[model samples]
Target: MGTVKVLVDDLLYYNKKDWNAKVGKAKKDNVLTVVSKIKVKSAYIYELISGMYITAATKFLKFTSK
Candidate 1:
């Protein structure tokens, strides 16, 4: 989550947008406001990969509730 957030911050800064524009889930949605389609795709990929890793780790450790 932290890694993804950092990537998002970089994306926001790259686009000259507010670094902390919103809070919680709203922040994630702000990525769409980026003008460059390529940058948006890159940010989404970064977030997806980070989330995948987190999901895999949680499953490996059996931390998720059934």
Candidate 2:
């Protein structure tokens, strides 16, 4: 398991790894538990325990091992 801190306000979270499904939003500085990491195309996406997907880009999140 891992953790990630949201770097921007109202960060978009998705329901699918394809990023075509809109789910909800997460606030900045919110630390979330990551269930897993997936690579879609050339981008890495993180799957939260809540079943939400978010970008794993360094500019958007700060990742840490738990």
Query: What lDDT would each prediction earn against the true structure?
Result: 0.23, 0.91
- Runs of candidate 2 with Cα error greater than 4 angstroms are none
Candidate 2 residue pairs in backbone clash: none
Question: Model 1 segments beyond 4 Å from truth?
Answer: 1-16, 23-66
Each candidate: RMSD to true structure? Answer: 12.5, 0.9
lDDT of 1 by residue, 1-66 (tens): 222222222222221222333223323223222111123322322223212111112111222121
TM-score list, all predictions: 0.16, 0.90
Task: Please name the candidate that would achieve the greatest TM-score relative to the true structure.
Answer: 2
Worst 10 residues of 2 by lDDT: 17-26
